[model samples]
Each structure stands twice: as C-alpha cells, then as structure tokens.
Target: MFWRRWCGLFLDQKRRKKSDATYKNYKHILGEFVDQLPASVRFIDQVNADVLDSHMRYLESEKAAPKTISNKMMVVSFMLKAAGVATPSKMMELPTVEEEIPEPYTREDLQALFKAMTPEERVRYTFFLDTACREKEVAHAQWADLIDGKYWVRKKTFKARGGKERQFSPKSHETRLIPLTRELMDMLNARRKSSKSQRIFPNEWGDPEGHFLRKFKAVAKEAGLNCGECETTISEGRFTKHPAEVSCLTRPVCEKHYLHRLRKTCATFWHEKHIPIRTIQSWLGHKSLETTQKYYVASAIPRIVPPPCSYSRRICSNSSTLVLLSTRSSLGAVRPEAESRVYGFQ
Candidate 1:
C-alpha cells in the first residue's frame, strides 16, 4: 500500500508539467530509477540514504559517468523530498567520485564545422555554439533582442507549467545580454524574411525549427562530418593521404546530446579567449560558478601551428580582434589583424 502511495506521488510529480517534452524527461529519469528497485524494498521505510547509495553504486558499476550518475541522484533526491521520505541522517551526503574533464571541439574544428554548414545554418549554429543558447532559444530568437552588438532573451517560453508561462526578461538571473557579431546580426535580419512568423531559425515546414536532429544529420552528411559514432575518429585527425571517415547513424539522435557538446565546446572556446570564469558562468546557463569552472580547464598540449599574430586582421571580417594568450597568468586580447597571415608555427 505504501509502495503504491509513493508511486502515486511519483506520477503526481510528473503530472505537474503537461508539456510532452518536459514530462518526457521527468518520466525517463525517475521512472527508470523506480523500475530497477527490488519490489520488496519499494515502500517508503525501505527507501533511505543507504539504499540510495546502493542505487548510485549500481549506476556507477554500470559505467555511468560521474556527472550522469550525479544527475540521476539529484532526480532521486528531489523525488524523495517531494514524497516526504527523508534521507538517512548519518549518510545524508552522497559524495560522487570525480571523473576526467570532458574534451571539446577546438577552434580549428569549429572553423571546419561552420565552414561546412550552409550560410543560414552557419549563422544559427554559430550563435548556438557560442552562447550555449538552448535549442528553442536559438530557433525562436527575435531581432528585437539585438541591440548594438548584444541582445536580450525574453523568457516567454521558459516553461509551460499551466495555461500561463513564466515571463522573465533575459539575464533575469543576473541580467544576461549575449553579445553577437555584425555578421550574426546581419544573418538574423536577413533570415527574418516575411513569408513566416517571428521564428529566427524556421525549417522548411515553417515551424519553430522543430526537426533539429534530422537537419543536423543531413548537414553532417553534407559536410563529411560525423556524429556520436564517428565523431572521435575524425576528431583524432589521423587522416593520411586519404582522410578516413566513419559511418553516420541513419536515425536522428537526441538534441540534448548535441547541445551538451555545443555548450561544453562554447565554454572551452571562451576559456581560450581568456574570458573570465564568472562571465562564462553566465553564458553557459550554470546556476553555480563551481559547475561552470569544471569545464574551463587550461590545457598544455601544444598545437603545431604558431599562435595568431597580435594584430587585428580582415580574415573573418565578422570576427573581432583574435585573442590568443599562452598561459593562464599572462592574459590579454590581441587584435590579430596580421595573425591570419602568419601560420609558420601553426
């Protein structure tokens, strides 16, 4: 009976959001947790900090990354709290083992990626890759947000809790105005052609850029790039006389997977740009600065190419001064005007 009651609480938690996407995430996460529990120990008293630890251990033994298992733990903790089930007092703090830092795409890799994309997609995804804007935000961007070289995001679509949506202004957390380039602005204006409504990245269907994975795979295929399966092979850059490639999955994958990669890569790029960790904390949509710092590690591995010159160049006219610094201690922004011309060390 208590087990059934807790299950009811779980369903109630899921029902708080009616949106398919929102509910889907909650169901997949919490549902999986409950399903794996032994039936005999499914009641409220049987669930405790020790059992939670055991479940976490199960997750780790199954080869889950620390971050992933941590997320699952958070979901479980939240659920238990909502159900009035208390964690054990002695073992309340469930510590997670640290994992290796994530590898993100390099600036060179980004150049190849965007260059391979069509003009429109290049504009859209560059903003996504840079700002770490959620897919919906990228798709629904408005020209009104653009002001000078920066823009604001209105939170009309933050969530669909009920008939009403929470309306918060951009950077409501700390007032986040994402900066953009003239080219990005121009692309936004050019793309806002009249036939459709106010969507920034409308698909062929003229919807809010819905079919993301489908289009992503198509673009990847066209660009001679790979996704999950072959992403590493090409990333290794082990190509010989003939560049080796990998097979792409025919099915469209989840948007979050790609978004995670894009978001992490954006943090890495900004880290290289010498942007302050606090600034990057805002850009990456992290609530805590500690969560943000994990991704901005300094790598010592040297690239074959020499650093760009310390002068602003017209190579990518849209790009501002190319900033390249060697060490964390020595920090400055170089215009790199002539940096494009020098590739001796690079």
Candidate 2:
C-alpha cells in the first residue's frame, strides 16, 4: 500500500480514539514526515531503517527540540508497526530529554500583569491563579461544578447553540476537587449574581471563551513584559508574495506570560507552605507524584529562615493580601508559629 494511504488509515483509527487536538497533532506530524520522504520511497514497505535515520537527521537539522523529535519518532514508529513493518532496534534509540524546571510568575510580574487588566479580567485571572486549573478546565467551568465550597474537576457535557452536545474531559481522565480561598469564593459569588451563562467565564455567545492566551499576551505586552528579542514571520495575506518578519518588540508576544504559569505558581505556593507531595499531586490532578514534584514543587523550598517576632506584610500582587507572621517563644527564642496567611481581595 502507498505510504500516504497507510497513514490515512492510521489517522482514521486515531480520529475515533483520540481528542480533536491529539488527532490534529498526529496529522500535522505525520504530514511533515510524509512530506520529507524521498520521491523514490512511495510505499510503506519502502520505509526502512535508513529512511527513519534520515528523518531523524532532518529533524535535528531543523533544530527541533529533543522532546519534540522523540515524540515525532514515536508517532512514526507506531505508524510503521501498524503497517506491519518491523522497526529496526537501532532506530529506536531516542535522544535524551531533560525535564525543564518550571518558571512560575514572580510577585512583581503578577502585580504588573494584574495592573494591566481591567477589574473583570483581574477576577478571571485570579480564578486561574488561585485554583490552578488548566486552560480548558477553566473555560469549561460552571457554577454547577461547585460543591460544598470546592470546585470539582470532572467530565462535563456542554450544549452549543445548535443543540450539539460536546463532552469535555480532564487531561489523563483524572478528576479531583480543588478548594477555593474565601476571597475567591466571594468574588465568584458576586460574579455569579450577574452572570447570565452557566459558564463562569463565557463569551458573548454564552460559550466558553477560547482566546485567553491571546488576550493574556496582549495584557503582558501592555505591561511591557514581552521579551523583545524573539522574532516571527507574519503573512499579510493568503497569496502575499512576501511575509513580513517582526520582533516581539513590535507585538505583545512573550513565552513567559501564560495561564499554565499561574497553575505552577499556585502549586509552588502550596509547596512553600510545606504541603505534602502527595497532597500537591492530588490538587494538581497529576496522575504521578513525581510529575508534581519535578515540575511544580521542586525548587519552591525556602532557602533562608528569618528571625521570629518579625512579620512581613505585602499587598498580594494579584489584588489580594498576604501576611507572614512569627512569634517569640516563651524561652526568648524566635520561631515561626504558623504558615503564612493569604487574604482575598475585598
């Protein structure tokens, strides 16, 4: 069978089993692989260890990240296996992928971002930072998900304007309860009274808003948080002879300002409060405690201990208030008596 035909069959199987995003990713990667194949090799049987190695070389030459290359190789290997072709053992040697440390937003960054947002936008982002919910989860959030003052993350079915029902599931199909601070609860309650849609944050059409990252980048740009060195090409039109290359200095494009960073920030804060690894993992809805530790809680350990009887108070950068208090022992020794207290915005 032709290579493209075999790939089409494989993708059809995936289309039924995978999410839309996953299916699209598979199609994109496989399309790139097929495009890179030599003209002489037109069939699945024509793909060999040399072809696989050459593809790997091409990916490396393009400067793809090690993790990205590994993922593409996995997809290609799966396709070959499905086509009844045995992949060479030598070709299975994947590159080492180092886990990157998480970068949570700093207090100053949070302050600046919040300052650039309107009141409604501030509340929306505050919900993101406080609950540590993923973008999809937040988008699909509804008042019905709240139970006993905690938000429940689970599969939900939403109906669109045309009466088409779509089901949304959490990543890894794992569900957990997320507790909300009193301040966040109050803010949500106020929002609920005025909200006409079931979704906590809905668009004008009463559906989950999907342009969060774009709007967030705009806010970050307004706050002067963009890294001006990054460059990208933008097409003027579909048939434009030449696209214009631009730098981040001309656009609000920064890799650092994203919703996931807030989730990491929340997890790090819990870690700094001495929360157990298992607890943080559950709160993060991570299937593995190792994932929670490696990505979110690894570098949050306090490096220095301050003296007792010294209290530090600061307005929460995200429009809240936080205070750290310590008391002197009866024996005249100073030590922390309790964890830091965080108050929500009034």
Which is the leading candidate under TM-score?
Answer: 2
Looking at candidate 1, the ten consecutive residues that score lowest on lDDT are 336-345
TM-score of 2: 0.79
- Residue-level lDDT for 222 in candidate 1: 55
| lDDT of every model, 2 decimals | 0.55, 0.74
Pairs that collide in candidate 2 are none
Off by over 4 Å in 2: 85-90, 160-165, 235-242, 296-346
TM-scores for the candidates: 0.64, 0.79
Candidate 2 lDDT tens digits, 128-235: 877889999998899999886678999987786677677788997888887665556667898999989989999889988888888888888987899888777766
RMSD of 2: 6.1
Please report how far candidate 1 places residue 202 from its true position, in Å.
Answer: 4.4
